[model samples]
Target chain A: MRRTAPITILALTCTLLISMACAVALGPASISPGSLVTLPNAWMIIWDVRLPRVIAAALVGCALAVAGTAMQGLFRNSMADPYIIGTSSGGALGATLSIVLFAGTGRPVFAFAGAAIATFAVYIIARQGGKIPVETLLLSGVALSMLLSAFLSFLMYTAGRSLHQIMFWLMGGFWNVSWDDVIVAILIPVGCLIIYLYARDINIISLGEEDAIHLGVNVERLKQILLFVSAFLTGIAVSIAGAIGFIGLITPHVMRLIVGPDHRVLFPAAALAGGILLLWSDTLTRTFANDMPVGIITACFGAPFFIYLLRSRMKA
Target chain B: MKPVEVIGIDVSYGAKKVLEAISLHVERGEILGIIGPNGAGKTTLVKAMSRIVSPENGTVYLNDQNLDSFSFREMAQQVAVVPQGISISFDYTVRDIVMMGRHPYIERLSSGTSRDLEICDRAMQLANVTHLAGSSVNAISGGERQRALIARALAQEPKILLLDEATSNLDISHRIEILNIIRSLTGKITVISVFHDLNLAAYYCDRLIMLKDRRVYAVGPPEDILTTETIRAVFGIDTFIRHHPFTMRPYVLPVYESPAALGSARRVHVVCGGGTGSDLLYALHREGFQVSAGVLNIFDTDYATAAALKIPCVTEAPFAAISPGARKDLGRCIDATSAVVVTAMPIGQGNIENLRILEDFQDKPVILLGDGGNPSFQDCTGGEADAIVRGLLDRGAVTAERIEEVLRVLHGAA
Candidate 1:
């Protein structure tokens, strides 16, 4: 109950809206606000090309952040995120399988199934008795991620013609997004809302599973619901964009410092900040870097920040 | 109906059994304490009652209903548990932690109401943590954090509260303060707590269930359960149980004795009275000496110590001088022993015979225990007792200052 939580959430929300407008307007073929009105080609560029891409990027970012925040709370480890826990890798492999076998017909469904299975696998592997120790959970996630990546790599190797599409998807960008993808991304808000309803339970559970139980949280069921929802969100993000990495890892952590870890405030704040972050990252790559994969820029910044977190946590 | 009843519950972790066929019941508003040595399954029993661990073979009943029939929220509304301690991963404020106690009542769609906040504030006040409401749980001290947890448990407004050694980690003042708060909750909230400190359990609990080797060893009021014999049998230590001066509750004082040293089977008679010889008697007995003390009146403090240690004593009646029968018994005790040790006790008319009898055993090695200075024999019999001591000293009676030195001299003489 920090006094500044509402203010922080409101401020991040406004910032995210502004960032989304700038991202939609400032693409490679920059359409000015005046041109959007008079020029039909400019209007088509804005409507068909840039608008859906920017909207999907923002929604995917929100999904990843909400999933990450829930994960950090569920594991009671600040370092946990959808990407770190093999959810994204599982989604990547699932998408790659659909691309190789069915020509990407029902990719989101396959991705979601894969993500859910991987998350539950990691959970079962890490659990000892009734508790999941943080170290075991992290190590199990790493092991599962490696195995999923291997499957993804094998799928890419056998597909000669669709290899380029798989490679581009794996690198993660919104260059080919459309209105249909935007329609699918609408599910992100529904997932976020469902998770938001359990924000208080997440706050109690982060204290520890046993304390959560004492406080009337159904700890095992809560863990299952959170993991399923996080996998759902991660699966959708991967299906729309690609296996984007650190928006899930870094945004929730930084927002926690500002909004002070009440998941009610933290979930919204992290979601908004994550949307702003990925919107700007996508904007930067498409505008200046000749539409390179946005995941490269994010990882370049995310890996170093992750190392800093590790070092600081070690000192603590 | 009892507020809580367990019907021969057995709990196990994997293949290891923690509690075996443990059955108990709690009255409506009494504080029932569970106490035992480590690994005696005290905490596991609490866990079973709280539904943190389901019993493998038996059922727990709350308000005459099977425990498993209630949902997690319903069970929490009925029973609140205060664990020993917890490390919060997030920086939740004390108020935030306490407000979580109202979760079972609050619907998922709505936040805590003004009434919930009122209960939180009242709970904080009762736990003496009102001033710390806004502080982060991580920033507070351990004792303060423990109190905040108590505040959280209080805010639950539960019908039955289970505490697993909740005050065991705090200091004496904090322990008493928190227990006092819980004690004030009696007649409204039924409490079942696990206690490591037997004295606190005795002082705070209305009744106690003592566990030994995973079974219910004894259950009664503290005065009846915390006896010298029961404590000796359960804890395997000698305890001097007495009523507290103010509360009249049983107070346990452990008679700290090291293991008996090997190869010393010699007998030493301690000539002590007026509580001077208690420590010496304990030390000698711990050192494997077949020690005996007396010609002591039945009411002497040393006589009590001797009795507690199970040392053979030649006792006289209270406030009585040494009788002929006691004197003859004392002579027999000294003759059977290898050495005599005279502690610094007052030489009154009633006990001067304790020193006079020392003369007959002159050839036996005699050791005088002094107060690290001169052996001040408080001779109320004037020069007569002093002359007898002087005669013993003239006949090579050695004087030692402390118990260690007395033990050394006795061992050397042996």
Candidate 2:
């Protein structure tokens, strides 16, 4: 268990690094070797535009995956994802309102607040008596996600002027990612580190709440901290990448199958794999069809993958 | 010294009260067993002791300090619990699961040290799961899983270990295996376990606390707490209690129900002695006959069985001759019952009066079990007891070769 993780993380980091280099060099109007030797234009585009977008995608991916891992641990369900329980839609709704009202200055703050509130709302509604059964929480999240998404759709329909910006944001892309965005998005790794600090507790919590408590975890406080951190991660990711789907849901699951459920190993591996997965999807969409949203590619793949997971888990 | 003390704790789920005003104390390093029928709050009481559920009105003290004052880590370091059933979806290895018991001691962000791993290794060896350490916990059988959970608790090395039906899912051998593991830990760590099997609880637990209707029904050594009266009262079943010859512990055997009910109105009197009449009484009771037994010596095994079944019995003082007042009571019982059955008890000087009562019941339906040996074989009065039994058999008494035939004769008379 000890030796397996560092090697896996090292391998993933190397793959992520290699993927980033290839991705940065291969956008629309690919930088030629001769141009790389001759002019500052290629250098400027690679440093300014491509690096920030890749870095944004990587950060958002890492954040979403870590948040998804935390949420899965919190709910103790294998199929739990960030967006499955309405966190993404909540963040989107908050950002959309900010885009229209505060003109995007408070988008990150509002998005974080919105995601946190939605998570708690679903949690509060699902809790019966004293226990929140996994099935009840899953159903409640699905219902609330639909309800919130419907409200978001209504808001988008009414906003005639900001429809394009809302559509682009909702489609989920890193087209306008800037240094300020990167600074706000740095919370993804910082939040992941905080989650890592509680990784052992989360591992026990994933077994069951009663098991966690009897094992010496203050379950209520651990839950609050994990939920807050995960929601904060989704909020920050949504502020930059606009509800990129599936990296959070699939990354941890894939890592768990490979590395097992030891959170000490699972969390870091998930973060790296998530970064690589999103960076690959972002590079593919930009290279093949520059106008296409990264969310489209992710959802196109994620929805089917999620259905497969649901079906297989049901059979299990 | 008391390691755990529960004081008037009340626990309820929502509006339904599971346990009310329950109190108990556990001596250090003693194996205390908790037993009750379904829905009797056995699990709730254990939870309260471990501080998993805070009581609405009472407090739990650990080593004379309030349980609420301890942080979760400190509480876990002192008390380890192996819950009834745990389902794991995330495929954690058995070693990974067992290592979780060391969570309270290991600081955050740092894995277990060499000493912690050594303790975990020894714990696995103690639980006999060292071979299964690397296997997925979900892939094992129920008994293996139970052992793994026990190994986890052992890894914790707490002062107290609480088990809630920990062996319920296991098979007979595994049940004994887990119980034996607990039995070995008796003097080293305090154990409070809930057992559904009364026999196992009686065998393994040093002290047993029987619960009924959300209250402490009885609490003492297993021999005292596991009496026939307590079993019948708490479990609502007729059970015979006997001392295990090897361990000297009380063992309970439930009286099996009869094949079919003859009629509730048919009443029968049994003339039995020694241990021969106990089975007949159980058979008659199961067949729905209102049964009574008599003139049995106080120390007779049949008398104890009769008492356990709560049958109205006429009794004589042990090793003494039957009194006239007891004989009068036996006469009334004979007049009231529709028929009488006699078991093959050894005829003795003290119980010879029991044979004389047969002469009066010759006109009635008396089912007598015939053993070929004469009553004089056990008689101190020479051939007189044999002659009396022979006369009773000739005077229109029905002969039965087996106890089931006695039940048949009663049903026939009914």
Candidate 3:
């Protein structure tokens, strides 16, 4: 392990804690520390409005980043993320269906079911003679994502009144988050813990499947577990925050550069850093941009960083 | 029981058959080598043993237990395979990769213990990668990376080690270094390796299994298996097999002459003795010349070469003077050939008649093969051999340096 890994993780943890505190205090009606002590309205705003929203954003961000890190290692491709294989589109479609048909009741359950089904479908489609080759898995993911997005577009066209709500949810924000959402986000850490147990296996498997087999990894089983868990994490994060873009894509990548590729260090480092990143992005939108969707800011930065990665990979 | 035994195993990838009814066994503590040309299923056989590929027809028994019965972890604890090479996607330190070998032992809930660390260190030392333990696998050389892989396999502390041409990608010195390391592990770890280099296989392996068309063509000690005929039949190449001077192992020297390049089919007689004529005989024989050699003793190296090439040679008893009978055979050879080539061999009383008889063929196109600067004949017959050589030179015998020059002169005569 790099000597700086623990230090980086500690620093990210501190940064995440500080960022959450600042986010909770600095939204639209900025409440100073003194006002927090004296004003009942400030206390109500902090407890009922900003606190749950900020905490859910951080938790959802952690879930996405951890899932992204797992996906990248599982596929042995640095470009892989939870959404690259249709999880987000599946969740989005499910969420859209809920919005159009039942006015967003049971949206999280629908989104998770959609995400899990889509991931397994991709896995099954990509399997050839009992092995899931990464290239085929990736292609199957893209194909399924396009089909799910077409379904999502059709649902949006039919929903006349809930169209505005669907568009806002698709853009993705934390304005509607509450304590109940935070309770659901608690499952994120449990999922992260499960993935962390396989960090060493992931390290071995990233070398290649054949090498992994030689090293005693039950490669097919490990692939299934990682895919299912990552999809679970991404599904929960999408259900909670409406598919926040690039927290999953960009955070794991940037943290990998800092902490190196040992998933033991990378998973936690990316989790904290991702939480910090989305926490700050949500804070920026709600405090300064008049509650605009945080996904816009994330995508504005994420797409370019992704493009840079592609160009640099080409050069390499 | 044998350490590894495959019984009537037929392996295939999808619908394409790779190994057909192949069976072999490795005794405990033997470094068994699998050798074959490309597409011979050597690697696939290794895969079958490691349980990477299951055989379609029969069973593999490891320590008399069914290979299918072993869990993946149990199998890894028993066997470790060092691949030809691996391209790691991450920049894992050499230590991290080595430590991963301890994965099968380390429980999923616990990190590697201090005992595991000690094993990893020892493995690195054995593989001579201790100094590179902290270097990124990608930053190191190919040879170092392969050593790290060896270290990783060693860290598994396996009872059986499998190498799939693991050293094939390295240079000669690295290959020797790695093989020596592996050789040092023989009595403790049973090894089954795939070899592309026949010389390395002959030198290092305790026994070799030669494969052809996805079947075991031959299996025996190197001395028995690496014969010119077996190699020619299996690899379709002409090889000169001889004992290595230092190791006494059978050394294979490939006769790389392309038969199509010089297929003169003209008759040539080589008059040589000692070991000097072996290369010339091989060259002439490979080029499709109807070559005959000697008045050589039965024990002469040239006689052996001639025998190996299936050339018609006139041979006498070892250490005996050229008799009247052998001289008659030599005369017949000289008369049947269009050109006669005499190599730079030591002349002695026993073989002096080989030179004196050449004097009778004065009209024949004679090429004296010599190393340009030196006297071709080691004239231990004193002035007698020198006088005969001078007489042959006077009668228009052309001295050509090197075998190619001799072949050019003979071709010109043709």
Q: Note the DockQ of each predicted structure.
A: 0.85, 0.69, 0.82
Model 2 spans with C-alpha error above 4 angstroms: B256-277, B288-304, B310-409
Give a tens-digit lDDT track for model 1, residues B258-344.
Answer: 547685888889989999998999899888999899989997999998997889999999999998889999999999999989988
User: Which residue pairs show backbone clashes in model 3?
Assistant: none
CA shift of A43, model 3, Å = 2.8
Which scores better on lDDT, 1 or 3? 1
- Tens digits of lDDT, candidate 3, B1-414: 889999999998988999998989998998999999999999999999998888999999999999989988998999999999988878899999999999999998888789999999999999999999889999999999999999999999999999999999899999999999999999999999999999999999999999999999999999999998999889999888989999999999887764566588799999998889999998888778899999899989899989878889999998899999999999998999999888889999999988888878778888888887234688887689888888888888888878998888787777
Write candidate 2's Cα lDDT for A60-83 as tens digits: 989999999988888888777778
Residue B7 in candidate 2 has what lDDT? 87
lDDT of 1 by residue, A277-298 (tens): 9999999999999999998999
**Better structure of 2 and 3 per TM-score:** 3
Once fitted onto the true fold, the runs of candidate 3 whose alpha carbons sit more than 4 angstroms away are A37-40, A124-140, B258-262, B371-376
Name the lDDT of candidate 3: 0.88
Cα lDDT tens digits, model 2, B1-414, are 589998898888879888988889998888999999998999989888887788898889999999999999999999999999799868888999999999999999679899999999999999999999999999999899899999999999899999999999888999999989988997889999999998899998888998999999999999898876788789987677888889888888886663355456788999888898888887777777888998998989899988877888999888778889888899989989888887777777777777787787657777777564222235567877778767876786777887777777776765
Which candidate leads the pack in TM-score? 1
Tell me how far the alpha carbon of residue A1 in candidate 2 is from the true structure, in angstroms, after superposition.
1.7
Query: Which candidate model has the greater lDDT, 1 or 2?
Result: 1
lDDT of 2 at A136: 86
Task: Give each model's whole-structure lDDT.
Answer: 0.90, 0.87, 0.88
